[model samples]
Target: MITLNNKKPVNIYDPAYDKLFENLQGNILKGHGRNFTSHIFLRFEENKKDKVKKWIASFANEITSCKKQIKENLAFKRDRTSGDTFIGFYISALGYSFLENFNSSEKETDFFGSMKDANISDIKPSDWESGFREDIHAMILVADDNLMLLREKEISIRKEMNGKCKIVKIENGNVIRNEDGAGVEHFGYADGISQPLFFSDEIQELETKYKDVKINFSSFFPLSQVLVEDPFLKNEEAFGSYLVFRKLEQDVDGFKAKEEKIASIVGRKTDDEKEEIGAIIVGRFEDGTPHILSHEEGIIDNLSNNFLHKNSSNGKCLFLNHIQATNQRDEASREMIMARRGIPYGIFPGEGREVGLLFMSFQSDIKKQFEATQIQANHYKDLIIGQNLPQKMNLDCFGKKGKEINVENFVKLRGGEYFFAPSIPYLKNV
Candidate 1:
């Protein structure tokens, strides 16, 4: 990760370590959806803090051989093939409470405290599921291509930590890919489109279409871009990062019906047109092509993600679209975006389908990285139609999708937790 005279990596990414300042948990920057994923949240019994620490030491030891997961993860991405299981450990705010050494902040910047503010979203921290609503000690993320293997690992892990800690909830997840192998969420839109490009010794080219901008590893990103070094780490100097977990329940049918109904009034006579209307609201064409750059010639390359919002003239791309609203065009937005590793989960049978996304991400700061985006997505109902005075865009109106539009909330937060996964060396000492 040599700093070039021009501010880009001169040649290639340095070795992963020399490139990434922090020893990141390998799974943080990995691709989405190979096969199976299980998110397990736990709570330690009172007076058993020592035992829980010992259990983590043991769990960390069990996955010692997997520290090279960064290498394996990239290989799988390159081959589009399934790799071995990838594991990561994280601890929640409540988990930090049990630690006598931690000096937890009571400020609104803290995720747990912000959740209680109510201004963050309609949902409150108290509304979360049992373990996540309160004293969640830790989270164990198990990912693999084999569902059976994941299940076995989950069981074995529980057996190992049984009395030391207890399982509060587990959301099983997997990549919902199409026949052609394009990743998508349960809502049928292309997923995993947004990722930051890094100029490193290893990263040679843009990995995804959505990542139109690349920053030198030494410039903005490092261990600092992905993790908090102090307080969260026992050694304050080793590798470890903050994790944000969100259980988003998607109203799949509701969203589709709304889209079709809205598109119908726009005189949409074909499925393509209706889908296009949906794309306008989503700010993309389901194939991960941004509406701001989509054309009859097909998806645009370099301009697909016009980071400058240069083409957003005459309300061409409404501020209401999910991507448009959340993908802020301001230069300051660079810090708001983070690498998202989301997985779709749920059954597909019956009238009342119970499927959604297990949205997870890593960031340098929750407030700046994830929360800022969330705030932008939730608000911004006023649309500045071209040069017109700011006004609300009526959803029922045809062609208003291009106006200042704040799309309705299609996903509800169920439960989640904030955690810090420390370095292997620090964990052993803990």
Candidate 2:
């Protein structure tokens, strides 16, 4: 049995976690590191539960495990030639109800509810895309570095589901990188910089790299933050995680135009000065520089995730900024952090195109982690990505104060769902 302390970080490389890692699915502990992804939403045909179960059991053999993913990641880091495809399978609460014979009382409460009824602030099912309005039983995530290979894999899966299931929607995602090769969202801000670290080696690498800098923030987290016992599997090592997927479309033209307008209103005259306003709103510059540490973009190292909002009360980082509003840099905020493995989708240099992020986050609890953070962000009106209706923001950074500017409707939620990425053992046995 794997022992864990609530306050201590779980060492994923330890021998005690061997069975857990073997049984757990990939892309949960860490990212799959693929450039292209296809989200295949599936709905099994009526009275086809037995066929669906058999197909899933056979397909589970293709899903990557945490142990194999770690090895692949290390091999890529050493020689940079690993180009294998990764796959993940997730079942919604409605999906489970259709397949399993268990009672409602035996089900996980949060996993059984649909995202349409989630009641997240500012999210309305009426505003969602039509594809998400239908009943979605399960999703198959296929990702790869090669576009051709990714497409081939998607076709193979589609062909396999011929009469057993219907494809509800297929959302394709591609990684958009900046000139510096760092991953960025459609809005031009660096994405997925701040994350929870589970492995000891990853934590050690960061500590060693930032040895000179006085690191105050801790990214290390226990496995319990993301993993929960699989209700369908009896194995002691069987575990699963809750996945929240949202297709957030960005209005590039509107956001950039209003960003400049807000900058001008904040009394910024020069181009460099105007850039700081965007930084204040995003809590990071376009080039991923932490605005709390440096006023200029690309001036400081981009991987600096060690700063705290408590120390920035002097107005270096605005209290209403995206990062500060979502994460208050307190002990309570630590529990709200989720493993974000989202990727950008649609046309780049977005000009009236469906381009945005396929926001995917894995956590142990949706209510405590994702929903709570969204509520907190809504309360503070996080200007960049908060879903709440647009409101005036206080421009209290960069030696300026008392200037309130209104910027509205930059990011819109198209559609999404809540899913449980079950253990490989459970899938095989079912």
> Weakest 10 consecutive residues, lDDT, candidate 1?
382-391
TM-score of every model versus the real structure: 0.82, 0.94
Tell me the deviation in Å of residue 2 in model 1: 11
Clashes of 2: 0
Window of ten residues with lowest summed lDDT in model 2: 3-12
Please tell me which predicted candidate would have the highest lDDT against the true structure.
2
lDDT of 1 by residue, 320-344 (tens): 6667566665567666777788888
Q: What is the lDDT of residue 214 in candidate 1?
A: 57
Q: What's the true lDDT of residue 176 in model 1?
A: 78
